[model samples]
Target: MGVVERTWSWLATGAHWSGPDGVWHRLGEHLFLTAVCLAISCAIALPVAVLLGHLGKGGALAVNISNAGRAVPTFAVLVLLLLSPLGTHGSWPTVIALVLFAIPPLLTNAYVGMREVDRDVVEAARGMGMTGRQLIARVELPLAFPLIVTGVRTAAVQVVATTTLAALPGGGGLGRIITAGFRLTDTAQVVAGAVLVAALALLVEGVLMLAERLFDPVRRRTGPVPG
Candidate 1:
């Protein structure tokens, strides 16, 4: 049989979709890891980036540090993390590696977005008696919202793709499917697992793109203003 037909047959097998080791279960684990890592990374990166951007200080240094982090391979980090004390705790190493993988983009985009906000608009807001907090809340964040969301979208897609690596440490995820297939020499199953991950990443990107457009202030303003 052709590779495509074999993969389709594997996917059509009901047993593969129904057990503890099923696609549904693996997908759940993958999603959970993605959500947790993304949330933690965002929580850590965004505030620092925004604060630096607002202060107009240390942003270059911060971005440089994060960029240096990106130069290190995530798998290497995961392996080192797995060798540490945290490895005794289930999933913590995987989570930490993925969070580290996710932080640079979040930090870079948020900092750039905030720094890129129109200075004239900021000065105008300041002239209107806006305090630092008010300016950030009402002006900087809203203006920077699109790029910030873009960073999130980028990070989410990346995390979804990378979470497969979690299976290396016996952390259950779709990567398990691929790794299992490799062990058994089942090419069809490996392909199916890859297809599933790719599909999920595309789905996430599309949803976030729609959300970006919906929340875009410039787009909203350009649309017919409320009568």
Candidate 2:
């Protein structure tokens, strides 16, 4: 009860958004944290997915690993990470956890996209003396771009949501608002924090949608997804 009262008092006065370091101060951190995790995921997942999809190897194993990653609830991941070398003591745990969470979509999409590319087109590309790298960069990836972008889009949304979990371990993000509200049992505070998180997720989705359009010529011809 005291916690709730205190939380509301702070919120009513806008203290939640204006505390030392404050909501505005940490907004950048939240975006930065999400972006960093996503960038790292792409760096590893793209190459691995492309190669795995092209070779048609270890796919079951890879998907299984990614699915298992999803089962390890985000909060549990954060708690376990805190117990390890990459915990409240450091930021790497959140990075590692988010990367794990981001990989499945990428791996699945890459494999599916490459497999779905017209085999005849691939043969033509090869028949024309296109090298493996050339086929992938020119023929495969472009056609695969929309689906691949879909994976990135999914990853971005997921990362933004999971980032709040990272806050529980003191890694810092908008989750701080959520956890603080929970500790205080303040409904308004909780709502305020939740509202911000939802807004951020929508913003990320919009940006990714734009990215998909800008890169996917096929999409341009077909038109945007029905909202």
Candidate 3:
């Protein structure tokens, strides 16, 4: 049979969708890992980027340093961590590696978004007796919402796709499916695993894009005026 037919047959098998080592379980693992890594990355990156951007100080240096992480391979980072004390902690190396991989875009985009908020609008808010905290909460965050969401969308999708690496260290996730297929020399299973990951990444992107449009403060504010 052709590879496509074999792949379709593999996906159609109900047996492959049940049990601990099944597609559902692995997909859940994948999503859970992605969520953990993305949340940790956001917690680490967003505050620092926003604060630096608000102060208009130290943003360039911070962004450059974060971006430098992109130069290093996440797989290599995972390997190094696995060789360290952290290796004993279940999934810590994978989580840390994924978090680092996800941070550069979040930090860079958030900093850029904050800096790009209109200076005149900021000055007007300042002139109107708005405090720094009020300005950030009301003006800056609203305006930067789209770009911030963009960063989140980027990071989430990247994390979803990269979570497959979890299987490398005997971790769970859809990567296990691919690795198992490789071990068994089952090309069909590998293709099905890849397709699942790709589908998940696209789903995440679409959901976030929808959320961005729905909750964008600037779009709501600038919406058509009542007749």
Candidate 4:
């Protein structure tokens, strides 16, 4: 049978969807790792991006440094991390590597979004005696909301795809299914695993896109209200 047919058959197998090493368990592990890493990346990147973007000070330098991190390969970082003391901590190296990979887009998009808010509107808000905190909360952030959500969506999908790397370190994730298939020379299993990862990434992208539209403050304000 062709790889495609075998992959469909493999995915259809109920036995592969249950148990410790099954698809569901691996999917859960993949999601947990993505969530944790995305959360950590946001925590580390957002406040700094917001503050710098708000002040309009030191933002360029900070953004440049963060963007520079993108050139570093995540797998190399993971390997180096595994060779260090962190190697003993299950999943930390993987988590750390994913977090690092996720940060640049969040920081860059947020900073650019904030900086792109209408300067005239900001001046008008300031003219009305709006304080720094007030301007950020009431003006800049709401205006930048869509772009920030875009950054989040981008990061989430990237993390989902990348979390498969976790299996390389003997950590749990969908990648393990692929690696297992490789070890056993089962092309069908490998194809199924790849399909699962792609489906998950697309699922995340779709959900976040819906969220972006629903929660966009500008759109809500400008859009028609229900009668």
lDDT (10s digit) by residue, model 1, range 1-227: 98899999999999998788999999999999999999999999999989999999887776787679768987778888999999999999999888888888888889999999999999999999999999999999989999899999999988997798878767878999999998999999999988888888999999999999887887687884465
Ranking by TM-score: 4, 1, 3, 2
- lDDT per residue (tens digit) for residues 18-118 in model 4: 99989999999999999999999999988988898999987767678666877787677878999999999988989998898888889888988999999
Clash pairs, model 2 backbone: none
lDDT of 3 by residue, 19-102 (tens): 999999999989999999999999999998888889998876767975697688776777888889999998888898899889
The true-versus-predicted C-alpha distance at residue 110 of model 3, in Å, is 0.4
The better-scoring model by TM-score among 1 and 2 is: 1
The local distance difference test score of each candidate is 0.90, 0.81, 0.88, 0.90
When 2 and 4 are scored with lDDT, the better candidate is: 4
| 55-158 per-residue lDDT for model 2 (tens digits) | 66877876687677777788887788879866655778888888888888877777778777899999999999999899989888888888888989998999
- Clash statistics: count for each candidate: 0, 0, 0, 0
Q: What TM-score would every model get versus the actual structure?
A: 0.95, 0.86, 0.95, 0.95
Ranking by lDDT: 4, 1, 3, 2
lDDT of 3 at 151: 91
User: Which of 2 and 4 is the better model by TM-score?
Assistant: 4
